[model samples]
Target: MIQKRFGSADTTGRKLDVIGEYLSMYQKALGNTNFETLYIDGFAGSGEVPLAEHTDNLFDEDVRTVIAGSADRALNVDPPFARYIFIDKRRKCIDALKAKFKDSPNAERVNYSIGDANEHIQKICRAEQWRSQRGVILLDPFGSQVRWETIEAVAATKALDLWYLFPAGLGVFRQISNDGTVDQTHEASITRIYGTDAWKTAFFEPSKQTELFGEPVTKEKVVTPESAALFMIERLKRVFEGGVMDEMIPLGKHAYPSYYLLFAWGNASPKAKALANRLSKAAVKATDRKHGRIV
Candidate 1:
């Protein structure tokens, strides 16, 4: 499939490894539940990457060459999923993905599309293939590309599970300032990502900042980067029927949490909670080993 230099942020590999691990675990844990499984990768990049060649290995297995994308990894797992849906915005990525699977015997089971992941995902929710299946959707966007409405749609399905690579530290901490005033566009992005403007309540105090002359000032803001991340997680936990698990923080080579990895599922789903807990535990340990020291 499409191959890129293994040179993105350092935590990129950690994120992929954790996602791959969860996919394998979920398949093994629920494969015999008599339900069809559908795997979705939002922002599925080119099918191949230089994880081994350019960065330290983070996967459970070691490889020195190019590595399989999440889409391919899921396909290789035991108790195969019933269907695979991969969506990427880049046409080249889609073309490469198709080329990678073109000769495969199970190619017919995989579907690739070039478009906004959120839009296509809503379509998946409406498609007959996803109607009765257990959906596992992974969203690994570059920045604030995933919106809360997307998560809402998946949760509305009442049958979908979600894994989000939320750029809490990168997106929220950067845009939400120490002062009450937020960056214009970032305010919208963060509000949409959190699915509510109420998050500002967590960051800013009710008391307003006043001008030197005693005029009405904007609200005062006070919160740490870590707290900002928690706010996002907590807000999302409320949206999913299956609560969002404690976050798995992946460290950037720069020695900080690059993003918060979280999973959420439908309401009143004990199975969803159990599976999410398992995945959360595994991701926590994996992130510790692979990227914790850098932090």
Candidate 2:
């Protein structure tokens, strides 16, 4: 139960906290196994964020707590070999991560690659070694910075389990109303990630009222954000025949603003499903707290 702050506000920090808890619980329940190899962070930040508290707060904890946890598990488990690959475009962030973890016990097992995550994801997947073993990729980007090609490449791995962030707020829905004439670049990216052009059809379809999870909800109707999210998840499931897109971890509905949607995907094992359900419940509770809604 390690805790740390990120931005001056609590939103990002709280989200990270929940994710860390979920990862820890997941690993613990998973028990000792040879689930080794790669633990990747596509948008690994500078490992810390400078913020101020009443007496003047300055430093935050390493943001790569999940990766660190994986490293710890690797060390204590039967097979003590595991690798951590962190990718970030900012030189400062990469350098900071390197400096922070340089003296850590698992330092040698960690590697940092500097570049756009979308650009290098494919190259990493195509590597000779990744073809084998089970690897988990955590693709948490700011918004839509992650490209479809990158997701496609990672999903193509067949052995990689992807936990991704979907843009659900203003970033994605803003473009939903545009009729067929939206920018091709974004559309292309979405298509590649989704592995189909069906979303385009959603854009043209008229809005409608639908029941989601047995609850009546209404929105633009065509290409609901939930559907878009599920679409991508199903594509990943198909790509990884052995895997399944469990369910959406509802981060609850908030009146304020948030940047992205949080979701997880992996081999649809009982453990994975249980972990996802736990995460979903936690997210719902957190969301309820934020919105002053009953949990």
Candidate 3:
């Protein structure tokens, strides 16, 4: 098999570690339940992500290790999920995953698909019998690939917990221009991501200074990159019935926040919500402590 190199940072390992931790806890909590638990990896990449370029900052003592992708971590969970679904847009990625897991003991229990992650996710949510199925989905897209409706679909299931790697610095923060001169394309993408145009008011404000012609310049941005993640959390709470985590585990090099790892539960039941919340919080905290962060 040809090894494909994937870009990663110190926070990449941290993000994967958090996913691994949550899956283990998720399995343990529901392992005895009558409900069939599932693990779904949206935007599932190759089985492993090689970290040759950014190994120095990785938390693990084995600096030369290849980081296990989310799908790999899910399969490693003890008394594994009853079913697994791995979806990726790239044919090569799905092929690689299929090849990597073909000989596994649980290969029969896993399903692989090559297509849009959002489409596959929505189909699953709409088709599933949520009452008898409990699941966790990892949405770690390359950029702003996840649409708002897709998120709504997940929440509608009322049985799946979501770990979303929102592109805070890399996608949302980049789309928003400081001078407020966002192009039509960016405006549309941002609106699609936030599910509303309210972000225009939340992240920007009217500038006191005006152009030479006395016409007001585009609204000046009122928020910084660090605060963007917080804004997203607020938007997520509106759609996720089980609510969202108050804070996100920022994924990037030290002090340079890129991706925001957000957790939201779909289950509306008090007991389910509390368990998911507790486990998710512990997972993030454990990952941070392991990385020597002062969380």
Candidate 4:
């Protein structure tokens, strides 16, 4: 059974719980030797969140429960050799993570980095210690914090399985369509993640119609969260080799916010495919639950 972390239930917490459970199960089914370089949480948050679902009251938060669960599973495996590398931009998040995992037996094996995840990737990848191991990177950026070049660089490593949290609905598409300023930095960020100029075409093309908030949309349409997500998933598929793409929806009645799109790649083995399928199904179930459907 999976251990529950967050006390008060909310959309984000439930979603994290589902992800953690599925990931742990996937690791177990794949067995101990399946991966060498273990987990990577790019947008590693505090192991909890402070805001309650309906209230504005502030409280302590720590969102690293998923990482904690993954670590526990890794340590229980036979070899006990897997390592976790967590990266976060905020020092507060780093401190919170440290406090949350203070008692973890695998804490010593964990590597925590404070700074831009992209800037540190080369250093982490080139380090002699991780050269021989296979990797699974969980990129859960808050918005569009991750760059496309970083994704490409990580892909170049040729031994990575990426589980990305794309900002399709929440960030890129919405901003580009709604905001007039069209900042170079934002454009560059989108290009980096998409790894191509195709997005420009999508934005400018007259015939392309995208759906936003369940409404039929055109090039001039405001970027809906769904379309942005779909756009990212499609582009990511083009760049990454031998990976399955799937979206994760939340479960239960509190599901109005957003969903996750998981990109699984590396080795292209049967195990990878199977894990992708499992995760996809799990995502749907979680989404259903989030919407208050009986699943």
Q: How does residue 219 of candidate 3 score in lDDT?
A: 72
Give model 2's TM-score versus the native structure.
0.66
- Model 4 agreement with the true structure over 1-295: per-residue lDDT tens digits: 1323322355554555555655555566544653465677676666654433344445634333333333333334444446777787888777877777778777787788999988877566555344457656777666677777777766666566677766665556555754223578777877776777676766554425466568765555444556666777676666566565565442222443344555656545576556666664665476565535432
Name the candidate that leads on TM-score.
Answer: 3
lDDT for each residue of candidate 2 in 1-295, tens digit (9 for 90 to 100)? 2223323334444445445544544445443455555667787776654333333335643233233322233223333236778888888778877777788677887878999998778888888364345556667665667766677677666556566666644334555543334577666655655557877665455436465558654444355555666666665565554454354443323433323344544445576555556655564456545534431
Give the Cα lDDT of each candidate.
Answer: 0.73, 0.56, 0.83, 0.59
Q: The CA-based lDDT of model 4 is what?
A: 0.59
Q: Tens digit of lDDT per residue, candidate 1, span 52-129?
A: 333465654544456677777777777777788889999988888888878876687898889999899887776654
lDDT of 4 at 238: 63
The worst-scoring run of ten residues by lDDT in candidate 3 lies at: 1-10
Model 3: per-residue lDDT, tens digit, 139-242? Answer: 99878889988989998988999999987887778876666777888888878877888888888888776663665585787766667778878888887888
Candidate 4 Cα errors over 4 Å, as ranges:
1-10, 34-37, 55-81, 126-132, 178-181, 205-219, 248-259, 279-295
Tell me the spans in candidate 1 whose CA falls farther than 4 Å from its real position.
1-10, 50-66, 129-131, 206-220, 283-295
Model 1: how far residue 29 lies from native, Å: 2.3
Q: After TM-score superposition, what is the CA distance of residue 67 in candidate 4 from its true location, in Å?
A: 12
Ten contiguous residues with the weakest lDDT in model 2: 62-71
How well does each candidate superpose onto the true structure, as a TM-score? 0.82, 0.66, 0.91, 0.72
